[model samples]
Structure formats: structure tokens, C-alpha cells
Target: MKRQYLFSAFLAREKCLLYYQGTIRYVVVTADSGERIQLGLKHFQPYFSALGLRGRFRLTLTETGAFDSLEQIN
Candidate 1:
């Protein structure tokens, strides 16, 4: 049988911190409560274009409780 997972959503603000690790670029997300989540270049670029790294966003998690994706809420 196939297994299923649960997903969670939370509100977080876009926090852009551009940096390079050797050659790969990354962006990190910071919540108001002081939690941080780092995103990869592939993931960050697309959303950054749409959201522009400001305002509030709805953060979604994967079935395993890891950061999956985000969308602008405000």
C-alpha cells in the first residue's frame, strides 16, 4: 500500500540573504518568531521573481515536515 504524509502551513516574511557556497547561491527565510529556513538557488529564483522578497507569505511544508514551498499572502 501507498503511504501518505501530512503538510503544514505557516506565515513567514521573505528574508533575502544572498550568498555563495563555492559557486552555488542560496536564500534564507526568517520568520518573525526567529526561525530560519534556507532555500536553494533553484527554489529561490522562481519565487523571488513573483514575490520580490518582501511582505508576508504562506510557507508550506512537505509530508515529512520539511520546507516545501511558499506563496505570497499579502
Candidate 2:
């Protein structure tokens, strides 16, 4: 089974990296409520070029509450 969540965030400009579970290319963002989110480039490749640093978007999180996809909101 899997779960999905929706939230708004702003892409962070500061370079940050995570090697969690043997994965890299993670992008860090700040949630609307001030929570920091780490999104992986592997999952966000399609939207990568479209979303600039500090860009705002509505995130669709896959299982484990890790963002799977996104739609630009601003």
C-alpha cells in the first residue's frame, strides 16, 4: 500500500545533499508551514528545469511522504 500527500513549498537556494537510503541529488525546500522538505532529483527530474530556486509549487508526495511530483503554483 502507498499514501500520497499534498502540500505547498518554496524551493530552497542553499545547496544541500542527502545520501539517505543510498540516494542523492536531493533538493531542499521550505513548506508553507515552515517544515523543511528534501525532494530527490530522481523523482523530480521532469520538473527540475521548470522549477527555479525559490519557486513555489504544490507537491504530491508518494509513499513515505517523500514528494513524488509537483505543480508550479507561482
Candidate 3:
């Protein structure tokens, strides 16, 4: 099995964090050839929508020695 990153996102309406236990299937390289992981939030749309989150939600990554926000992860 391929190594995958565990992700989490902040739900505004819930006023709390929503954890997404899933894997990133794609790896994107930057202009400098640095590898970056990409994860889609569509799978969690129902959960987020139910929480009344209209705008973009904040993502957080929870990995050993790799805990970071979405912006920092990229």
C-alpha cells in the first residue's frame, strides 16, 4: 500500500475542527521540483455542508513530525 497523509479541516459553523481520516492519491511537484500532496475535499462536502460551512474551510494535516496547516503543507 502507498503511504498516505491524514488530513483535517476546520468547520466554521461547527466552531470546531473536523478530522478527515483519508489518503492523498496524487502528488504534485512545484516549479522547483519539490513534491507536494494534494487532497480533495469533495468527499467531505456533505459533512461540511451539513455544518453550514459556505466558504472555503481550513485544512490541517496530522502526521508524525509533519503537523501543519494546509497553506504550510503546500
Candidate 4:
């Protein structure tokens, strides 16, 4: 079944590409339902830094549902 969720997250880490000087972003988020969702930055764009990967923010997503707008919570 499909569902919507609101969660808090941090830019946990990034994987460096050997060929390109870019990154594959990742985040660790604790959902409002107390579930953890770790994923890549296919849809998110949070500011990242070595000492600031733990920036806490909030986002919303729909799993197999509608793709609505996501927001960052302060």
C-alpha cells in the first residue's frame, strides 16, 4: 500500500565519484511515524559540509503515492 510521511533528516554522508568530481548524496531521516528512511539526493538539495552533515530538517514524501512538494523544517 501507498502512504505519505513527514520526517526529520540529516545529510548523513556522501559517496565521492572517482571519475567525476561530484557526489552521490545521502540522508538519514526519522519519520514522524518513528521510522527511519535513508536515501540518496534524487529529490533533495540540502546544504552540505564536512562538519555540518548533521543538519536537522524535515521533509515529506509519498511512497507509491502522489509526489507532492517537500519542505525543510527549522
Show model 3 residue runs off by greater than 4 Å.
Answer: 11-36, 52-74
Model 2: per-residue lDDT, tens digit, 42-65? 554444443324445677766676
TM-scores of the candidates are 0.46, 0.46, 0.26, 0.44
TM-score of 3: 0.26
Note the residue pairs that clash in candidate 2.
Answer: none
Local distance difference test scores for all models: 0.47, 0.52, 0.39, 0.51
RMSD (Cα, Å) of model 4: 4.6
- 72: Cα error in model 4, Å: 0.8
How far does residue 15 in candidate 1 sit from its true spot (Å)? 12
Q: Model 3, 1-74: lDDT tens per residue?
A: 22334333444544323334333322222222233545444434555555643433234445553424433232
For residues 1-74, write the lDDT of model 4, one tens digit per residue: 44556765544344323112444455456778798776555546444445334444445456754545455555
The predictions' CA RMSDs to the true structure, in order, are 7.4, 5.9, 10.7, 4.6
For candidate 2, what's the RMSD?
5.9
**Model 1 per-residue lDDT tens digits across residues 1-74:** 22222222222223332322234455466665557765554544444443344446556667676766665565
**How does candidate 4 score on lDDT?**
0.51
Q: Which candidate is the best by lDDT?
A: 2
Candidate ordering by TM-score (highest first): 2, 1, 4, 3
